[model samples]
Target chain A: MTDNMYIERSCRISENTIWLDGAPYWKGLPAASFIDFAKEAFRLLKVDYPKFYKMDNLSKLVFLAADFLLQQQDKDGIALVMANRSSSLDTDIKHQQSIQEKESFFPSPATFVYTLPNICEGELCIRHQLMTENIFLVDECFPTETIEMYAAYLLRSGKAKRVMCGWAELFQENYDAVLYLVGPNGEKEHTKKNIEDLFR
Target chain B: MVELKEELKGKIIEVLNLEDVTVGDIQDGDALFGDGLGLDSIDALELIVLLDKEYGIKLSDPKQGKAIFKSIETMAAYISENRTK
Candidate 1:
């Protein structure tokens, strides 16, 4: 049953750089804010999806990195398992600010929509048309073991032909995204330790 | 009418996140949903919010959206007659 299980590929996105398979994929400018840097990376990606601009910082980070990973890997029957630490706190704060001001109590529907971290997952599924089972977990740290088990369970139980798992966390300007696809065959082993090591 | 159409077009582009589209790209009579501009249900909701926020027009019923948002021509006419802002 484990014959085909392997980590097909991986991508990591930090504040100023993007890494794919442990190497520098794209490096952004130093002085620019993370949001601007993400926009630069999106422009570099040259993806035609116009909805990227409307997304919150978290979704944009995950969207940019997942765009690369999904392009490089098989997307069919792929379930998404995403985790984050802040869990949409940045957008929550922005949404709160929109309504909390008594002088201008106008609550923006646009900012209010992105108050959940799982909305990033929904954005990814919408962009790629991935109708597979998806879940978003939150913890103080990267729940490496939980993600590994969940992805592995889905693959082994035939719930999904493949699994895409990662951590995409964004708060204020600090952000990180590391997405990896697991399938029956690949260069990297789909073990818990290997997945954890990729982050280091 | 021409100025209002232009203003509506600009608002639609800004509100809907039609990044690739410009005011010049939209024709007054062109359909705003399905096939023409390809906006979905979420964009429709955003447009409803836009009508209220920018023009001070409140659409209490979702069904009213279909007629009001049919085209830039219709939207411009409605806004001209009803907009409080």
Candidate 2:
């Protein structure tokens, strides 16, 4: 039954550009930093959520990708299975720096809240009001096969009506986010090869 | 008190990362939380840390924040009264 699942849509953010469903959607400034790019993309997308401005870089990346994929679509009962390579190291370093110096030791709640990789997933859930099964994994690579298997299992087991799976990695200036929506119907089959092709 | 209010407004904007908000946007009587600036609990904690690090005022009681963080005016008044720095 899970084999019947298909890739409905995909969104990617990399190289200061945003791609939606295998097409270039937005191109940011050449020298824009990750935060700058995110803000620009958010504005270009006309996102009205004010909470978006307060998110850390990792959460912002994931939020932007999810925003592209999930906009104008039914958000109910959609599970999220995401993985990343950095595991929130970008914000972890900032939090560590905030406390490393005894003279300036002030760990902020905003920064402390995003030290875990799964916090990005939590941010997405908050933005979209998703109250379904969700998981965030940390791996050295994208773990394409694992994400496919897990998302397919969720659909086949009736755990979720739809699943959003992807990789969101951000450490320092480097950031990459690739998210795809999987459901019972779509033009592309939800196979490992098709997921890999979309990622590439 | 006017000078302190402006300073607190600037500090709040900087500490809370209110990118879309400016010092001019926040009025002296504007509510810091729901309905006005729309700051959440996390912003409240940031303001607490701001008070401690900048004004040397440690908020020992969490309930005090509800009243103290009501507006820029209230925060400045509290800081003026209790600031050890």
Best by DockQ: 2
Model 2 residue A137 CA deviation in Å: 0.4
Candidate 2 docking band:
high
Q: What digit string (tens of lDDT, one per residue) describes model 1 on residues A1-200?
A: 46557888889998689898889988988878987898889998777877798888999999988988877566778899989999999999998987787855656667788999999999999998899899999998888888888898998888888888999988998889999888888778888889988889
Query: Tens-digit lDDT track for model 2 on A146-188?
Result: 8998998899999899999999989999988999999988989
By summed lDDT, the worst window of 10 consecutive residues in model 2 chain A runs over: A44-53
- DockQ of candidate 2 compared with the true complex: 0.83
* Model 2 misplaced regions, further than 4 Å: none
For candidate 1, write residues B3-63 as lDDT tens digits: 9899889988887777789998999999999888988777888888788778889888889
> RMSDs, each prediction?
2.1, 1.2
Each candidate's chain B TM-score? 0.95, 0.97
- lDDT of each residue in B1-85, candidate 2, tens digit only: 9999999888888788788888999999999999999999898899989999999998999999999999998999999999999
* Model 1: residue B50 alpha-carbon error in angstroms: 1.9
The interface RMSD values of the models, given in order, are 2.0, 0.9
Worst 10 residues of 1 chain A by lDDT: A101-110
Q: Pick the candidate with the highest TM-score.
A: 2
